[model samples]
Target chain A: MAVVVMGDVVQLLQRQPGEEGPISDALLLAALANGDGNALAELYLRHHLKVYRFLARMAPLDQSHLDDMVQNTFLAVRQGAHRFKGNASVQSWLLAVAANILKQHIRKESRRRAIAAALTEIPLETTTDETPEARLARQNSMRLLGKRLHGMSHKLKTVFIMCDLEGISGSEVAAVLNLRQGTVWRRLHDARKQLRVALAEYMEVDT
Target chain B: MTRCPGKEQLTRAISNDSSAELDAHLMECPVCRDECEKTRKLIEMAKGLPDGHPTSQTVTRIADELRATRPERDLWASARPGYGVVLVAFLLVGAAVFAWNYVFYPPSGPSGSANTNAERRDSPKGNVTASRSAIYTHSIEHKGYAFDEVVSLREGTVTIQVTPLKSNERFMVKTDDATVEVRGTVFTVVATNGRLVKVSVKSGKVHVRPKHADVAILTAGGQWRRRTHPIQKPTAVLPHSPDSGVFPIASPEAASHLTKKTDRLDRTDKTVPAPMKKKETVFQEGWSLLRKKRYAEAANVFDNAVSSSNGKDLNEEIYFWRAAAHYKSNQSEKTGEALTDFMRRYPQSPRMDEARMMYGWHLFNTGRYETAKQEFESVRQSPLPHVRQNAGLGLRRIEARQ
Candidate 1:
């Protein structure tokens, strides 16, 4: 009897760390289909924090609005559970949903803010103890960094977050954002170059 | 010897997998090295910014919401492995009930073999059995009527004080002679020897019928008599003067009318002996038993009273109480039979009106919708104002469902 190599391809896609050897995604789906609420809860618990963090970074943290986005993400997961084909990891599917929820939240907030000024004012504050010269230098550095990051294109910002902040591999970022791996690499390179030009003075002062 | 890398090539060169050729080019090229170092610092700076983790409360809130929103069946299934056992036990109990009804107490047809002797004895009478002892009597004074109580006419005569007469209220008084229908009034109908039915209206008016005779209306102070021959035209005057041994009355016509009506009837017909005072006590004991919800025992007691009375009127209250007992025990068929028998034997009874109302409801609950509708319609059209109103409501409900 010969085992097909296609089985390995399927296994490679679904492999997760800390999981017992390789439980089939089909078995997890079967448990869910049997009206297993605990299985659904366990699936949610595993990825909800990361999903929330992704949305919070993407959208302004209006406590109430963020809460609604979080709720909507899980609700979509629940309703879309049947459609899950085990092609991708559950974490990727959930992150996709969270991204959509964040996008929706941004659109809604923009419309709402257009009609009225935001009702909740976020209190901003400084959190460092420093001498006057140090404070001035820190302020200049922060301003330069913010101006550069803000000036970068949306594509570059996304690449920077995915590759640098989130520490996801360029390939995984391509998978998550549905971009080509080469495209992701190109965007990160462009963003870093733009930042270097903007922060040239800061780098000179630090040296 | 060196070449400066483009920004894209420089970014790729920082990767551990980049070839030594790319690294060698980067070390020799200051412009490329400076560009790569700045890109590295910028990347580090972006990573150093807040990671944007959710607060603990937010995580807790989301978890709670997920838990609360989870379907109830899922929680039960996950928590308990014993639900299958509980469900099976429930099904077993339901099956047992179904088995008991279909196998042990199968429904009987009109004249089926399943009919018990007691049921046979309770069947409608083919001929009116004349008995001196079994007279059922019911009387209502200022207080209205309770349909379940039997009226006893055994004390030679009983003065039934029908009071607070509401217009159109119908009362059926059954005597050996005929059934008397009263439309609101205080009246006394004395049954002597269970053969003579003499009616005297103290107030209001009463319509009297001697078994097969046309109804005759007797007004206040009016008297009517039923003898062996037939009821003579109602004489306006009293039959005996106040000087004669009877209650003294200011209206001589009324007093004489009552005396004459009582005297004309033959006393020779055997009177079903009046229930002994002790036996009456036992009848009351049975009634108390019914009130206590001891239906089976109460029915037995009522049976004893009826049988002891030689099947005569058998205190109407006894049968009424018996019906109630059967109803309490969920023996709806038996209760229906008892109520029907009560109606047949005491058609003109004061309690008949109430019994019919209750029986209508009982029939409705038992799914005898057509029969219940008929009963309700009858009461709705009844001359009694309260009965008409009650029956109208019941009819409306029945019609609404239909």
Candidate 2:
């Protein structure tokens, strides 16, 4: 990959798709620091899916809540764009900011009813061969899994979601959580063990 | 066979770490193998949950929110490192130009005359619109970037319309017997017979301080007039005594100096009905010098009266004027001493509000901001609105410095 200088980044951003190499996150963030709304829009287009999936794994947000969380995360991105030191990847920085927003929201909205409603709303993936009964069973099991995930401590749950579910690297998870890599792996192991015991009955039925 | 890997180790293996030894053990031990499989199956189920990607409309909503809340562009953000220095230098130069125009070369009356009777004279601080027959000397006294527009009226009527004075700016109208101070107001002062006879407020408020009386606040449509009394003959000069009546006596030296002005004092004596006594007419003499801005001489007269005076209320008035004189003459040490004594002795004095405000500025000019802030805060409760406003201005000055 060529080293995209500041001038090249703007030119590339201006160009239509399939013209040059993809713009780096750091360059997009630099544009964001300059108060370019286009950079934020581009960043959202490229990364909103990943951000949404990450939040869904951590918390059961309804469509409205999910939209608000993503909007707030990007808002934080816009505000703190100048503070990015390029020490970590943009994805890690984003996840760190998202984690903070998520924790704050959860603290403010402590009612279990919202989380329960979200558990039932988790979309089910089905195949043509799947029967109605099997689909219902799978949906119930998924709901139970989401409930259990929500039930875990926030620390253990975030580590599990970032590491195992989202496949974020252990080091990246550590950076996002501001912990040692060893601590991150330790929490991941603990989270999985807790989930294993809690889901032992469901596993037996699946087998 | 190796001991079966614990659940924590199995979870780790199923998550990120899959060591060769662990793999061999898992292959050899069915118990461990089944446990790891179950964990893997559970993990797969959790991972298989839908991503629930947001819709285009949701992204659009987020973009709209970002656009709505986006801060204005930061000029220096995109500039190269060296450009910041140049930008800051330019800003500094611009500030210097502004300070020079408004602070150093402040606008003055026509012909550079301090006593101009033009219908209106404009200044950055405020404007002075005087009557054609108005006999007044207008001067701007600078206190750093701030100033006071002092209009001393010897006689005749002057109608002054002043703009809102800045924290450091003051506007005042002074006569021999009265001083009208304001932050900003349109008011007219009529001085005759060596006295401010009548003051009427057209807009805003003014504090009218009549000699030997409490300060009076006059708002729009409010007017204060000195009580009309028959002009009497000057009192016969006698030895200094504490039994003097409405007529203030001066020391022998002060009496000789003030003898020529005795007729003016007698004519301007609006406060009446009491018999005259001794000849130490120091208060009236000092007050006359103060009205002429001869602050050093006035302070000297007041200083002598402060020791020789016997009446409590008379002493209070003398102490206040003495400190005020020292302050105006820029005698820092004497002002501090006089103000301290005045504040200490007359904490409950009717003139305490003005005393505190004066002390507040004296402390502020000398860099005692903490105590100055307290003094101004105390003056914030003054009954006179204009005095309270001046105190507010003083507080703002302290805040800006801090």
Candidate 2 residue pairs that clash: B249-B280, B249-B281, B249-B282, B250-B280, B250-B281, B250-B282
For model 1, residues B273-349, the per-residue Cα lDDT tens digits are 34558556766677566546576787777767767876574556567656655655567788788888888877876
Per-residue lDDT value at A111 in model 1: 48
Clashes of 2: 6
Give the whole-model CA lDDT for all candidates, comma-separated.
Answer: 0.57, 0.72
Candidate 2's TM-score:
0.42
Deviation of model 1 at B3, angstroms:
3.5
TM-score of chain B of 2: 0.35
Q: How does model 2 fare in lDDT?
A: 0.72
Per-residue lDDT of candidate 2, residues B1-402 (tens digit) = 898886556766776576888888988999988877777787798997767577777778777667656565555665688988888999999999878755665434334443221322234345667667778888877655556688899878888888776555678888887788998888888888567878888999898887766677878888877754232323211111112311122322333332233222221223344554332366677767766768889888887776665435365657877887888777889988998898899777766777777777778778888998999899798776655866787778777777
Report lDDT (Cα) of residue B374, candidate 1. 89
